[model samples]
Every structure is written in C-alpha cells, then in structure tokens.
Target: MDSVREQLQIFVRRFGLLNATCCEACCGEDVSLVQSHILFEIRRMGEPSMQQVAEELGIDVTTFSRQVKAMEGDGLVTRRPSERDRRVSLLGLTDEGRRVLVRIDRYMAEKIGQIFSVMTPFEREVTTRSLALFNEALAKVGEAASDGKNIACCN
Candidate 1:
C-alpha cells in the first residue's frame, strides 16, 4: 500500500501537474495545469456550460468561476449567456485559446510519444488499461463516499 501511494505520488509529480507554469513554447503563458485542463475541455466540448465544464472537471463552482475569470483575463476564453437559459453561462475558446490548445495538445502528445517509445506495445497497452481501471475504481469510490454510503475504510 505504501509502495503504491509513493509510486502514484511520483507519477503525479513527474507529469508536472504541480508545476506553477508550463513551457513558454507550449502555451507561451503562465498556464497552470488546471487552467490547461479547462481550455482542453472547452475545446473538446465545444461551448459547454460553465457548470458543465466545472462538473466534468470535478471542480467546485466557486473555484471554477475564479479559474474562468483568470482565463478570460488572459483572453483565452469567452463566456456568454446561454440563449435557452439566461442564467447559465456558456464557455468557449477564443481564437487565441484554440491556438494555445493546439500547442498544448501537441506538447502532451510528444511527451506521451516519448514515454511510449521506451515501452513495448504490450507494455503500453497494459499500462494504459491499468490506468483506466484505476481511474474508474477511484471514481466509484469517490461517488460512494460522497453519497454517504459505507465508508468502511474511513472508519
């Protein structure tokens, strides 16, 4: 258990998720990991509601609102009121945001490519599957706990 925890910590840090800023060539701005994620999701979902992106990212609305405000200041995203629901704010990337997302995508792809280049095809497949399984399991656990179910481990 300790080994698993330690290895996961190392893996998280190795991904630079804790980095204060990304490479200039990538976003050419002080984009944090979370901010990059917001941009990526907006591009992927194509003008989703702010709440939708926040929920998908598992970020609280208040926290997500702040991040959106910052991104807006950076001119990477724009928010508009939904036509169907005046109260709901929809999020979309600006032209600059799209460019930034492209750079970020390329940068991440190159990094993953390098990592996979070292491993055999089978190894890569297993690694990918294991990570997906781990994520799914954790999500289930999180949902159960939040729903106030038997948190036996917590007890």
Candidate 2:
C-alpha cells in the first residue's frame, strides 16, 4: 500500500493543484491557481480584509499582497480602504473576476462529477464523508502547529 504522504502527493499531482496556470482554458483568463483561490476566498468572504483572506489561505501577508496587487492590475480584484478603518484594506471582485470565477466553478464541478461518476453511490458518500473528516483533522493539525505545538518529524 502507498504511504499516506505518497497518496496525498499523487492526488495533488493528479488534480493539478500545483499547476502554475490552471484556468486559462476554462475561464479564458491567465489566472494562476493561487489567484483563483484568492478570488474564491474573496467572493466567499464578501469584502474581507487583506489580512483576513491571507490568514484564511495560510499565506503570508507580503506574498498575498503581491498576488493581490497583480490581480488588481489585471482588473480582477479591487482593494479599498475600509470605511471604519482607513488602515484596513478590504477586497472585492470585479465583474470580470466574477465571470471568471463562475467559469472556474463550472469547470471544477464537471471535473469532480466525472471523477465521482466512476464510483458507486455508497462509495461516493463514503469518499465525501472521508474527505470532510480528513479536512477537519488537517485543520486541527494546522492549528496545533501554528500554536507552537511540536509535531513529530518523519526524519
């Protein structure tokens, strides 16, 4: 049997999670995978602060800022000072961004549907539940590591 890390690595590769640009064909834009994630988060959070989105995505502020800047240049995102706090920059999606996000969503939905089509109904349910459980466990581990808890090293 493959080790857990090996299985995860294979999954990631198969899903194209590490690709540089993933949505050009589907969305008709040169959006990187990271930018797509940022767009999704911004749309989901509804004008979240730059820092808030960064923390949610587990990305450092500096790198996130650069990505956001590039996105803003592309007219896919807008950053404006919060009315209540001038220091805080809130993010929003442009119309173009929204369209692109919709395309990406459709593409992903189709891709996931195709993957799940091969499974039995019971298998699909189990896989969905297992993924949720795995994500919850991953979040807990992330929180513990962020809180300075020592995690065992493979080495």
Candidate 3:
C-alpha cells in the first residue's frame, strides 16, 4: 500500500498542481498555478488587501507582492490604495481577469466532473467527505506548527 504522503504526491502530479503554467489553454494566458490561485483568492475575497490575501494563501508578503506585481503588469489584477488607509493596497481583478477566471473555472469543473464520472454516487460522497476531513486535519496541523508546537520530523 502506498503511504499517505506518496498518495498525496501522486495526486498532486496527476492533477497538474506542479505545472509551471496552467491557464494557457483554457484562458489564453500564461498564468502559473500560483498566479491562478492568487486570482482566485482575489475574486473570492472581493478586494482583499495584499497582506490579507497573502496570509490567506500562506505566502510570504515579499514573494506574494512580486507575483501580484507581475499579474498587474499582465493586466489581470489592479492594486489601489484603500480610502480608509492609504498605506493598504487592495486588490481587484480586471475584466480580462474575470473572463480568464470564468474560463478556468469552467475547465476545472469539467475536469473534476470527468474524474468523478467513473465513481459510484456512494464512492463520490465518501471521497468528498474524506477530502474535507483530510483538509481539516491538515489545517489543524498547520496551526499547531505555526504556534511553535514541536511536530516530529523525519531524521
């Protein structure tokens, strides 16, 4: 039997999570997986500040800022100073960004539907539940580690 880590690694590879660029075919833009994720969070959060988005994504502010800058240059995102706080820069998706995100969403939904097509209804439900449980467990682990708990490491 494959270990949990091995299974997750295989899943990530199969899902193209490690791909350098993911949106070229679906959205006609050379958007990296990270950039796509950034776009997604921005849309989901509705004009979140850069620091907020970065924290939500678990990315460092400096690196996330650079990625946002590149996306801004590509005309997919806009950053403007907050009226309430001039120092805070809030992010928004451009019209083109919305179009691209919609296309990517459609593409992903189709892909996921295809993947689930072979599964029985019961299997799909079980799998979805298992994924949610796993995600919750992972988030707890992240919180513990961030709180400076001594998680065991492979030596």
Question: Which structure among the candidates has the greatest lDDT?
Answer: 2
Ranking by TM-score: 2, 3, 1
**80-117 in candidate 2: lDDT tens per residue?**
99999999999999998898899999899999999999
lDDT per residue as tens, model 1, 66-109? 99999999999999999999999999999988888888888889
TM-score of 2: 0.90
Better of 1 and 3 by TM-score: 3
Q: In model 1, which runs have C-alpha deviations exceeding 4 angstroms?
A: 23-27, 147-155
Cα lDDT tens digits for candidate 3, 90-133? 99999988988898998999998999999999999999999999
Clashing pairs in 2: none
Q: Tell me the lDDT of model 1 at 139.
A: 74
For all predicted structures, in order, the TM-scores are: 0.87, 0.90, 0.89
The parts of candidate 3 lying over 4 Å away from their true place are 25-27, 147-155
